[model samples]
Target: MQLLILMVVLLALTTFGFRLGRGRAIAASGNNPRLLHSLPRYHGYYVALWSGLPALFLIAAWLMLEPSLLHSAVMSALPADLQGLSEERLALVYNEVRNVARYGHVPSTDAVGQAAAGYIGVRDTVFLSVAALALALAVAGLAFARKRIEVELRARNRVESVVKVFLVLASLAAIFTTIGIVLSLLFESLRFFQAVSIFEFLFGTQWSPQMAIRSDQVGSSGAFGAIPLFTGTLLISGIAMLVAVPLGLLSAIYMSEYAAPKFRSVVKPLLEILAGIPTVVYGFFAALTVAPFFREIGASMGLSVASESALAAGMVMGIMIIPFVSSLSDDVITAVPNSLREGSYGLGATKSETIKQVVLPAALPGIVGGVLLAVSRAIGETMIVVMAAGLAANLTANPLEAVTTVTTQIVTLLVGDQEFDSPKTLAAFALGLVLFTVTLALNVVALSIVNKYREKYD
Candidate 1:
């Protein structure tokens, strides 16, 4: 809490110092307006950047490195016999240490608890010392920079350059985070591929993931074929798109082209409420309502349907995505130039015809973008499938049968007690990589289509 408060105080002080520096620079230049380089706000921004950025960078770097350093030190202090433990076992020990340090009570041996408490004390002392030093340096630097503000400082241009650098850093952070995730997934998937052949995982129909814990265990060589999971995911996604696209597009068309202002104002918000509905709630709705309904309907039609069917989950997911597609499509449709509609109307086209022929084509790119966004949402959906799509990985395309998706398998694989290094558990990472690749490819294709459509208009 003290650290948080210190950070907040630092931010406020930095902002105040920047404003003061800018004001001072502006006042000093009042006698010679032509000598000023840039706006007063820019000058202020420059000072704030210098005051906060370096200290923040130092703090971030220290925080990241400190944890690993502390962990390594604690591990080294452990008995020599314990030091030879596997990485997973070491992680368990670390977790116990963390718990003991946090609660001041050991769930295990008293000696271990004492060791944890000692480690925690040392870690906290070191962290606080470093933080204090950093804070003091930041304060001294801020004061020095504030004293340097003057008419000839070119503070505004300097500030603008700093702002640009900050923006670029922010973007780089996001890109780096994405790259990190991909690399982690790739390495884990590579581990999984070593255990199970890529061809078998990609094309084989069976997906029994119960592997041997011991060398003597029977039926331990579990097949890692991923065909069924992929099929189930595709089936569910297809069903969801079928339910979402037409309804969302029609709603968007009505709202953009025909609805009165009063009706649209009321309806648009109501439509968006679907997006606000918690996905867990949608999950239960799929499990309790849609699944049972489908089963009953299938019975009436003399066809077999599992109690937990893909159709139920997919349909609910589609309903959840409708607002996403409709709202985005409506915005793009409304943005279409008025001249196109007018020309169509002059050619004896009705309102519906003008919208269908002129507005929709003009807005096709953005609408495709919206639909692709919805597709990504569908692919990544978890809760609805977990509840309504049963854990049977059926390779068949029949949506009525019980089938499992990649997300469902990943959840099941990681949910309970498991060994992360085992083929069974690491399979989740491989599935995740495949899922990521598929979604990325879909996005690329969708964006390409949207860009081409946009180019036509341009």
Candidate 2:
């Protein structure tokens, strides 16, 4: 609550500074914005940045350091026996203190109660001091900016430089985060490959990853074959793409080239609403409705179909992905130059011929991008496949058989408390590494196609 109040106060001060700076700039220009070096708004933004940025930096730094400072202060006052406890025990004690201080929990001991009280007091004092210092910094910044605001001040350039630096920092943060993920995956996958052969994981057919706890137990050497998982993933994703591409592309063509304006607006939003629906809901639909329906149909035809089949999951996943393809393809087709269509028509072509030969060709790049994006979504999906398709990593091309994808296995492997050093847990990372590589490859292929075949227009 104190932090919230401090933030609100800082916001009010920043807003006030903006208005004051703009008013001062106008007054300095003899009540004429035209005489100023930059717009009055830029001066306002300059003052706002000055008022907020330093205090924001201070608040961020204080928040980051506050926990450690409080911990050190409290630990220094702890009893020798408590201080001498193991790291794990000390962590538990610290957690107890925090709970007592923050959540009004009953402390188990007098030392804990006293430590919690001191923790609260120190935290409150530090927060109050930081809040005061932040406000002072904000006020100082506002005063400095107010003095610097003049007819000749280049507020726009300074503000834009700050924004450019912020953008660079944000980009670097994202790049570093991606690098961290790739390195973590690479390290864990290398560990997994040490325990299990990469060749067997890649090419072996059997994939029962249940490891016996004891050496004397049966099935002690768990099979680590990933071909079944890969095959199942491909089968489901391929089935989904087969169902999605035709429907999504044809809908895009109809909406972009043939539908009336009112009808198009109404129908487009309705179609896109499919994208907004939660995948869990689609999973439910697939499991409870679509799967059973397919099973009954197969039974009536004297054919066998698993209750949890790839066909059921893939079909529902395709339905969920329809909006991705339709929306992008519609935008790309609509953006095609009208001159191309007109030229096609002038050369004795019909409307359908003009669209098929000119507009579609021009829009192919975006359509391929959209389709590949949908394929990636299909591959990455977990909840729908988990609920609809059984976790039987059957290496089969028949969509009527039960199957599982890499993402489903990754989730299953990681759930619950398990030793990370075990092959079972590490297998998830190997699966993730493969999934990431496949997605990256798809993106590279999509980019290559877009760059090579894209039609240039005026």
Candidate 3:
């Protein structure tokens, strides 16, 4: 509530400064915008930026640093015995103090209640002091900006320069974030590799990852072979692609080349609606409806099939990903130049022949791109696989067998509270790094295909 009120106050002041700055600029130019170096609105915007930006940056920095500073101060003021406690115990005490201060919780002892009171006093004082400083700086900026506003001032240039700097900072932030993610995954995977052989992880056929707590425990050293995981992931994703690609491409073709405009409009939205449905809903469908149905069908045929099989999960995943392929393919096919079709027809070619030879070839790059995206989606899917495909990492090409994908295993490994020092927890990062590498390789392959077949038109 306090932060919101501060924001409202700052916003109101910024607006008032904008109006005042614009009025001052016009008055300086004798009420003639043509006489001024920049428009009145530019002067207004320039002052508004000055009045708001610094305070916002200050608030953001303070909020980020506040918790650590508060923790240090409160811990230093604690009894010497409490201060000497282990780091974990001290952290818990700090959390208890914050809870007492915020929630009016009854502390175990009077010392805790007093600490909480002191924390509240310190927090409120610092907050108010910072808020006052922000307002002061905002007012000073507004005054300086208004004074600088004149016929000779280039307000537009100054505002645009600030915007350009903001854009550069935003780009650098994104780049640094990506670098951080890669480094974290790499470092954690390295730690995991220190415990398990990379060769065994990559090639050994076994897939168990249970790490024993004691030497006497059964399965003391768990199998970390990832071949079964890789196999299962490929099997499921391949099945999904087999189901999605032909249906999606054929539907897209029919819609783009044959359907009436009204029919096309209605059908396209209906297809895209599949994409809007939540993945969890699809997982439910796969688990409750599709899996049982498939199991019964297999039983009737006197064929063995697991209740939780890859086929059910893969089929449902394909249904979820159909829009990725059909929507993009339809758009690309529609975008193909009509001149090619006309030329093919002029050569006495039929409509189907023209589509097959001229239209499809022209749109091949985009179709390939869409298929690549669908493949990625299928590979990354977890909910449906978890619900319908059991988490038994079986190395089999048969879709009827229970299997698990890399993503499913990653989620399972990190589902609850875990000690990061253990190989089991760190294995998740290794799986993630491998998944990232595979995704990058797929992208490189897709880019090569797209560049090779990309068509240029005059």
Give the winner by lDDT. 2
Q: List residue ranges in candidate 3 displaced over 4 A.
A: 213-218, 447-458
Ranking by lDDT: 2, 3, 1
Query: Lowest summed-lDDT stretch of 10 residues in model 3?
Result: 449-458
Q: lDDT values of the candidates? A: 0.85, 0.92, 0.89
lDDT by residue (tens digit), candidate 3, 127-215: 99889989998998899898889898999999899999999999999999989999999999999999999999999888778887688
Each candidate's clash count: 1, 0, 0
Please give the lDDT score at residue 36 for candidate 2.
97
Per-residue lDDT tens digits of candidate 2, residues 167-231? 99999999999999999999999999999999999998988888987787544788889999999
Q: What is the TM-score ranking, best to worst?
A: 2, 3, 1
**TM-score against native, each model:** 0.86, 0.97, 0.95
Over the stretch 197-243, how does candidate 1's per-residue lDDT look in tens digits? 99999998889898766766543698788899988998999999999
Candidate 1 ranges beyond 4 A from true positions:
31-35, 68-101, 106-128, 212-220, 300-303
Candidate achieving the largest TM-score: 2
